[model samples]
Target: MKHLTGPAYVDIRERALRFVRDELIPLEREARLGPEDPWPRDLLRRIWKRSNELGLLKAALPVELGGPGLSTVELCLLKAEIAETGALFALHVLGELSGPPRVGSLMNFASAYQIERFFKPVMEGDKGICFAMTEPHSGSDAASIKTSAVRDGDDLVINGRKHFISGSPFADIAIVICVTDPEAGPKGMTAVLVELDAPGVRMDETYVPMSGQHIDADIVFENVRVPAANVIGGFGNGLRLGMARVNLNRLLHTSWMIGAARKVYRMSLDYARTRMQSGGPIARFQAIQHMLADMATTLFACESMMLHAAMKADQGEDLRMEASACKVFISERCFEIADKAVQIHGNVGVTKNHPVELTFRQLRLARILTGTSEIQRNAVAREILQA
Candidate 1:
């Protein structure tokens, strides 16, 4: 649900914009460096701690839970601001502040002891958690994951390898999705809380993709033993619990995409208005104007879809089809906008020095990372044809 009103939201948006403009944007140069650079880590850690002190760390939580708990509408506005800054800032400010993908499920489903031992530390920023679901062979088909968790006396022994696990290298704990009963199909899948430091848990490789600062990992669990009580929402409820939490995850992705799209549009517009061309600025050309206009129009459409879906979610309305539609439309359109932005800047935009270059890489990855556009379309069609 929405926690902030009209003026309050405006204030929050303005504050976020200022933070990105005045504070985060200044670090864009250093943020673009590869993971081998030590400065980015130190800087991100400093900003993360400062963000907590400024009370900007709990944007992912709902209002009832004591965070500003911005509504989906509010998140759209705020994320756009953060996304425009750069990937490092987006990862540190929005990604870190929002907590992990499984935070909501953990809050809703974890037992008292689980809450105190695991959930609380994550919420308080004392630690981080990663959602380990994607496997080497499985991406969108989550139910096909082959990781097995078998009961062994009072403990559950988990064995398998998780690939493309975001935040794994930095996470202290992980919510592992595994097959508990091969005969039960989807119902056989179960969610277990695993401590990364536990014996037999190993993160051997870190994958640094488009954004140099963000790290994904290949995690291996070789007969890793987790307490029987660590099962979230009980055994055999993994898919059900995941479906409940992923709706918000999809919405958050839209917010991040739209935000970055807006940034590129603004940057392109500014460049067109000032860059000298044949007798005048490029902005004077009808072609440039049309491109700018199209970018703005597309961004507005994405925002409308995102806001509408978020509003419906806040009102407790089921938006499965609408959410899928938003995911597909926004992701594709955002990439288009970023591409147009690079064209507008010509050679300079293609350089590693430009923020647009980094933005282009990140937006391109967004299309495939979160349920791919193809998978989202399939989901929309299934819902439509369902009896």
Candidate 2:
């Protein structure tokens, strides 16, 4: 029943799907069947606890770190398979990255102690994380961040604002990026893990990023002091750490987009086969058949690229060029495939009852987040030129 299953990963896919159908799908259906029935916070907590107990929390993480230590390819396969579940459930499947100005930077460069204190807890599935990097002015140019973290004795005092960070509403902690020496530019940057319960941390009430998904608000740090031990990675390593996270996250994202595309493709195919157009099913029509074939072809190519990139990453191969290549291919192809899926659905595709609409909306985020298609192209171009 499982198609395109790979070595070591196929078993994980089967297990994840069983969880998907039995636990995730049922909960999703229950949530949808009711009028305004969001899963209660407690229920979500319980689901996460059960998932963690089931070893789904870190299926790809090393067993010592409380994960399965799956190869990078295995993680990619699992990521794609789990995303097929749904948005609320996917968070439990793929570990969270508290974004820029957050603990992710520390994960790369923190001292062993700093990592144990901040990064390990989340990777171990004990805590949820969010990133505070994007401010009103400092959109994607991470090097130009304005948040200041002034050193004071054993503490670093932070001051600035960040917006559009997801999962902050329920996160136990966050990664905050701040400029330690404004004069030194990006080289003076540092990332600190600021506990949400810490002093001088405030969430602005009105800064809503997205509805339904794990969207949160503006974070204001007014002289919030973090101990020197909390400094993530090396001095000025925030930029590189941020870059690595962005590059690696694309692989995870590749899995999710592929999952969404699969859903869209299935819906499109079903409609094509059953929905009558002229004298027979629309699937018989050349127009619809062409769309279906194109969709399938794109999926194959994109998934192949993703798996190749993942395997390379697992082998400690240089993945920058590959990540950029995969992200560009997956993101652009996803839009084309999703658009075709919607077209096949005709009028009803716009409605909420159809999954394509939601997939369409969510897939759009792929183009912007991590790196834009334009940005990916630029990276690819540079790599090609250097080669």
Candidate 3:
């Protein structure tokens, strides 16, 4: 984390911590209810408004794009601070999950039309956008996407089904990746912006995953007509465009993992120091001390790896391998830390609504999202073997 520390980073992190503590934690009950029920629109708007007022809403956007233009490391610092609070609304505090920040480096390729119609609204919190790349059959193998978008004179008619789309239920539009020229393989894939309300567009019932977040849904496109102008980053460049921000995204995910791991580690430490057995604290035992020591060391390593990758990204270096390695290592180790925290808490840890319990589920999901641990390993191995 030293590489990420500076006056600006410190200021941003402190503000983020304040925001999480003051604004999000009190709303924990509402956030807990979010998995089973829809978050009130007004409540979401209030959170976004407060975030915007704090100058944190679009902090990840480039300076040229009307944001403070924080570096990748700085942004991760902010993310880690918010996540360390164990607030369920950590993603909402900075609009990381479903707004402009989520668009990430892809904004570099957005056309003027996209900037005006799709991107700006999201930045303003007036609308939301979902990146629809994962299809039912192409979860990890993005190149095998079966969705098709055939050019029909002036429009592309999209026809396919996409499931497990994060933020799809609340998004006003989707950046749908489709196979436009099947014969061209990966080159044929193109990203098309389609309004969610467009004719032939249908959203299935929203579903909550093991992490207990109702942020994903299934979308069905039946000849959904999107104007040719909606194609962003040029035709046949969808894969590259979508991947442009992936390295940074992976690093940010690790930052959140580090934060959660730190939070649970502290919780376990406090519990071990106070939990009494045989007229003594559990911290007196070597086994408990060993677990705490392992958690602390692993957390240090996770932060080091994440910050190293973030610095490489900030330096404009290609981080394909480093990003994958960090994602796999940090996510796995952080999940282990959460497991240890649960063990330390014993009965209270696995109980519903417990912070450590929720962290456990969320960290478990982290390995599968942003490229599964297995897929990330394959990527690292491929890069190594090819080199």
All models: lDDT? 0.78, 0.72, 0.84
The RMSD (Cα, Å) of candidate 3 is 1.9
Query: For all candidates, what are the clash counts?
Result: 1, 11, 0
Worst 10 residues of 2 by lDDT: 97-106
Once fitted onto the true fold, the runs of candidate 1 whose alpha carbons sit more than 4 angstroms away are 1-46, 94-101, 211-213
Which residue pairs clash within candidate 1? 80-259
Give the least accurate 10-residue stretch of model 1, judged by summed lDDT.
Answer: 33-42
> Which digits, one per residue and each the tens of the lDDT, describe model 1 over residues 318-379?
77788888899999999999999998999988988477887888788889877999999998
**Tens digit of per-residue lDDT, candidate 2, span 258-302:** 988988898898888899866789898888889999999999999
Of 1 and 3, the candidate ahead on lDDT is 3
lDDT of 3 by residue, 248-298 (tens): 788788988998899999999999999999999999999999999999999
Model 1 lDDT, full chain set: 0.78
Full candidate order by lDDT, most accurate first: 3, 1, 2
Q: Please give the distance, in angstroms, between residue 277's alpha carbon in candidate 3 and its true position after superposition.
A: 2.0
| Candidate 3 positional error at 49, Å | 2.6
TM-score, one value per model: 0.90, 0.87, 0.94
